[model samples]
Target: MKIMNPSLDISWTHCGDGDDARYGKSVKRKVDRVESDGRKVLLDTNDSAFDFIPTAEPSPGTIEDK
Candidate 1:
């Protein structure tokens, strides 16, 4: 997922292998901690393992009518 703010220090990058790109891997870390390039995002931490996806929407969350 792309960082909402470029100024954010969060580290991330594309997968190395093509096959690996289909799915995602998770890393155990604090939200405030510095992330690495290969670490998958935390979609649901409550699962047996941290769940994640390859990509995500730009402005996360629903767009309600004003």
Candidate 2:
């Protein structure tokens, strides 16, 4: 999935390496942003993996901006 904002861009993809016994599936995330000098900065370009858990909805009384 990809998320874009006025000054930031974020994306992630599944690693397909299978799920862990405790942490769920594997995923890779990248974050990029535009600097004030009109340069694009790669905030995260590493191959690190993160655990992802699927959620159906937010907890009760969750406040959302959008």
Candidate 3:
């Protein structure tokens, strides 16, 4: 699997209903990648049932000086 951001935090939630309702819970994951068509791939699993939102905070080094 191609990791676009190893440390990136992703808040994923299943958007499916009915029989797939069991998977309709929000969870957080670290490993993620973005497809060329603007789809978020989580853990290398490509499923359209979930929507991913990036929740990673900026690194300390990127936010403040040492």
Candidate 4:
């Protein structure tokens, strides 16, 4: 089903490079969020083995560091 209110949210974030720590697996992700059917949710890839985080990508006039 296509999302009615596909809140278009985007951001620049650090992501994992696909490798294990012990087995040299080290990775990270820049999380993002979306709104659909009156509910907020995260945007993620289907290949990840974990859910790191889910949050709003900063909006204009919002607080952020330089």
| Candidate that would win on TM-score | 3
Worst 10 contiguous positions by lDDT, candidate 3: 57-66
Tens-digit lDDT track of model 3 for 1-66 = 354453342323433344554353433443366678966555534332233323333343222111
Candidates' C-alpha lDDT: 0.34, 0.36, 0.38, 0.36
lDDT of 4 by residue, 3-64 (tens): 33323322332333344423422233324453455443543654333333223243444322
Q: How accurate is candidate 3 locally (lDDT)?
A: 0.38
> At residue 43, what lDDT does model 3 achieve?
54
Cα TM-score per model: 0.18, 0.22, 0.23, 0.18
Q: For candidate 1, list the clashing residue pairs, or say none.
A: none
Candidate 2 lDDT over 1-66, as tens digits, reads 344552332333343434444243333222355568865544343322222222223335332222
Going through the candidates in the order shown, the clash numbers are 0, 0, 0, 8
Using lDDT, give the best candidate's number: 3
**lDDT comparing candidate 4 with the true structure:** 0.36
